[model samples]
Target: MLRTQIIKLTRAPIRSFSAAAVRTAEGDTGGVRSGGVASSDSFNKREAASENKFIREREMETLRQLKEKLRAQRKHLDELDAHISDLESTKGGEQN
Candidate 1:
């Protein structure tokens, strides 16, 4: 019962190669291979495209984060430079 539920939840709605195997086992195809070779090819292409899209989105997010970090660091460096210059000018005035 639990196994059946898992199968129902995990399986795609479309009939797949496993269904074809089951049909063959039940003599639906009389132990002969059907002409759905193109279906598997299309399925593989779709899966690959999905994985590629996922990777691309992750890479774009990582790039956006890095850009934000770089912008922050640049701002901090500029602030530090301004503070150092202010300190130097004050010390020069005191010595004069």
Candidate 2:
């Protein structure tokens, strides 16, 4: 999922580089020129992938914690509602 997002974000940059390379005569003329682009792009992609993974993991952890908190809150609300209903019924009995 994160890979898909990163690729989508970097697609334009990658395409622009490809287009420029095709337009330049010296772009692929030498071994060093070709290898340099490949190496740099590979390093950049690896770094981006790692960063995305970390972000995703952190988001998942936060979501899990939030869910647990919401569950506990719901339970507490239910208990309060039950207690209020019981008190109201007792008061009605006394009035009768």
Best-matching candidate per TM-score: 2
Q: Model 2, range 3-83, lDDT digits (tens) per residue?
A: 999989887653453535435466444335355778867866898899999999999999999999999999999999999
lDDT of 1 by residue, 25-93 (tens): 452424323557686667668988999999999999999999999999999999999999999999999
Shift of residue 66 alpha carbon in model 1, Å? 1.1
Number of clashes recorded per candidate: 0, 0
Q: What are the models' TM-scores?
A: 0.60, 0.62
Q: What is the lDDT of residue 85 in candidate 1?
A: 100
